[model samples]
Target: MDIFADFTQRINVAVQTVLTHYEAGDVDLSRVTVEPPRDESHGDLATNAAMVLAKPLGAKPRDLATRIAAKLARDPDVATAEVAGPGFINLRLHPGYWLKHLAGLLAEGSDYGRGAPTGRKVNVEYVSANPTGPMHVGHTRGAVVGDAIANLMAFSGDEVTKEYYINDAGEQVSVLARSVFLRYREALGEDIGEIPAGLYPGDYLVPVGQQLAERYGAALRGMDEAEWLPIVRDAAIDGMMAMIRDDLTKLGVNQDVFFSERTLHADNGGRIAEAIEDLRARGFVYQGTLPPPKGQLPEDWEDREQTLLRSTEVGDDVDRPLVKSDGRYTYFAADVAYFRDKYERGFNEMVYVLGADHGGYVKRLEAVARAVSQGAAHLDVVLCQLVKLFRDGEPVTMSKRAGNFVTLSDVVDEVGRDAVRFMMLFRKSDAPLDFDFKKVTEQSKDNPVFYVQYAHARCQSVFRQAEGAGLALPDFRALDAGALDALTDEGELALIRKLAAFPRLVQSAARAKEPHRVPFFLYDLAQGFHAQYNRGRDLTHLRFVNPDEASISLARLALVKGVATVIASGLALVGVDAPDEMR
Candidate 1:
């Protein structure tokens, strides 16, 4: 249960009662909010009710605050509701109020932080790296962020699909095919030295070429370019895709769908043409000339009439061209078809995780979503910023390996997956991140994953000590009704308040589509638990293992178990593990 939410409702009831007592008027409850005080010394919570409602009622904020505080003080749940600066109200909830709900944590266990159902089907498309090469560090960030968002939404009861768009139809893969063909020739005893420019030079292609040589020795070489292109391309794509999927598996990211861009080409059922025709029938497509692009114009820029989609009608800055003057569909045409395909799959919400370089695609994709879904689905684009590798405050050399980039597998193999996943989400998706290889593995408070896991480990350590003290592992959920009331200390109450905020926090994070908030919350929670544990060192009575007082120790044990449950749940959401021991 969300104890804070219940308190907010109570505060609303008191405000309603105050309005009736003053014979004033009804105020919008939605405008009111109950949140933690900026300074813990002030009180447990603060509200802006009086300040928000005074303007509507044509009264001074201080006067409104005084009247509302009087009514709130009468509430059974509120121990004190003091009026602060500018009609701000500070509230101290009754200790008993939090005490009762502490049992909700033990009862719910890891299920404590789950959010209510959103009743929306969401499709999260991410890390759709081309099948031309392995995933890089940039792709890793997108992969982790996207996977976290999908897991969060799934936990919130949204039917979510994790998807990857294979860009095998592009020029990049054509180069890959050529590169693999070179390797295949080399495997067939040809002197293929010095890879040509504009072709992939990654050594990873050696194996793909070897496979081609073993499968059809000298057969592909005799065939014409067009005849052998598809065969060689398909083999290379399959091999690269297998490697990419293995890298993702190492990072614990799983995709429900791997959509292929090749399927939208004219030779592959002409989905792009069908999409363009559908748009033309809707009166949204036309032959039009786009003005020379702003700033530096392309050397080949010309005012030619071509097939264009009215992207501006939705929200894009300009209408987008669907086809080139050569009668070939542009990349945006394939994208439009892909968007329409996702919409037809019954998803009411779409999320695209793109790299920072692809920021401009946001508007065009949004425009496509609006056109295809007819505004029935909401599209959110998360642009992941770059991650620079560092080592102990010095820049770490991430020399570009195969395909002109450091593969994601290299980073995961270097630092464990936990550090990679947690550090990837340690900052907002759009913010720049410096991932330090040395610092991430250090067992220090600055290492957020370690700190958070250590808190859970401490909780387990307490249970182990309890077992040695003649107390068995008891069913904490079935503890006495008064189990939590034994936790009346100020530190205990503060921890309870934080635990009680889990459900609300999960819901807020899901609503904002931000999974970075999970790590922030976990780190803050770990600090709280660590501080509480350290306090026991100075105060013997506060210790979790007290032979003199079995009941108090057991009640505190339940709270400790609650902490572990929440840590595990939050870690699961972020695709990290919550270990029972730091060792």
Candidate 2:
């Protein structure tokens, strides 16, 4: 049940009534906002309708607040409604009303917070890591973050497409081909020396080379660079992609699309030339000399004519180059085509989850979306900060036995997928996170994932305890129709109030495109459950299994079910498991 939404609507109705009373029909109710009070003791909710409507209606804030208060105080659902300092109206919902809200939660179960279709198609692109090797820990955060965002948007009724842009057409994949060739020679018993500076050094490619030998043997060894290069390059890209997909599967990130960069250069209706010509026809492309870049200029920097995009007209800091002196398309040129393709695919919004180091590219890509879609589409970039790994307060590095960087597989193997996924989103996306090996697995309140999971498990335990006592949960129709007057305790009201905030949390997090809020909200909900459970320890009547308070125990059991169901729903959004037991 969205208690906040209901109250917000009520407040909106009251504001509209006041506006009509004043004959100020032009006043917009959209400006009025309803929110939870900063301090719970003040009230369950607070509204800024009075302050928002005062100037528009030509009335003082206090005077409008007094009027709004009189209207809301008369609501049977509201136990008290008072005008607070200045113009805020604090509202305390009746205890019986909160109990009914708990019954609503019990009735909804898994379907709670799921939204109806909004008819908007959203594309969330993340983890566009180079297909050069296994994914390292750096890519893990983006993978989890992007996947969670897609999940959240999907749950919130948007048609979401999860995408991964494979960087297979670049010089990096060529290096990977050469590196895998080294391993190929090694597999054939040739003494290939140390991996050179520009080639990939990870041992993960050793398998690719071995596979190449099994497929082609020494036949391609006699061929020149041109002939064997493509063969080996294709093999390397496919092999590396396989390894990357395996790692992503370990973290439960299965993207709906893996867009290949090579396709943009080769097929799919356009290479760089076609897309550039299209932009030129639209007057976004021009041949001119760009001013020198800010800060230190490159050694090759010179005042020379080149093909450039007039991206600055939209929002970019400077007009970007589309073609180089050597007559090849720049990276930005390819991106214009990529974003244009996504726009044509019917996406209204494009979300790019990139590393913080790519901050400079954000404006250029945004300009590309605007230019390509003619201002009909929006592009949002989420820059994920770096993650530092630690084990027992000491920095964790590459595995000694594996002889590779600390890949995503290594972390997932050590900590399991749930901890990895949860801790990755435990902090804000732009904030640097320290993934502590020792702390995440500890069974203590300090570990948020553990704490939240335990709360879910505790809820399950309550159900089992009740079941063992021959108590069965009533059907939803009965639960929905039953009165919960026995649940009048302060703790019971607090728990119900927190449960009422679930739909609000989901809506806000989905709107902000911040999936981290789900985990954060789950932590608070878990803490509330624990607090309520701890309260029952000293007061036998407060316990869920109280023999002397059967009706109250049954009502609290419904609350327990609400906690478990909501926790599961939230963990599903974050791609983490909500365990029935801690172990």
Number of the predicted model whose TM-score against the real structure is largest: 2
Residue 119, model 1: lDDT of 82
lDDT of 1 by residue, 1-583 (tens): 8766777787787788778756675567788888888998778878888889888777789998998889888888789989998899998888877776778778877777676777899999999988888888999999999999999888877989999999988778878898899999999999998999988888888999999999999999999989999899999999999999999999999899999888888475388888888888888799989998989986545588888999999999999889878787888899999998988888999999999999989999999988887899999999999999878888766445675667799899998899999999999999999999888898999888889889888988999999998987779888654866679788888888888878878777777888999999999999999999999999999987787788888888888888888888999999999887778
In model 2, the runs with Cα more than 4 Å from the true position are 267-269, 299-302, 400-404
Tell me the TM-score of model 2: 0.97
| lDDT at residue 225 of model 2 (Cα atoms) | 86
Off by over 4 Å in 1: 21-28, 266-269, 299-301, 398-403
- Pairs that collide in candidate 1 are none
lDDT of each: 0.87, 0.87
> Using Cα atoms with residue i matched to residue i, what is each candidate's TM-score against the true structure?
0.95, 0.97
Candidate 1 C-alpha error for residue 510, in Å: 1.8
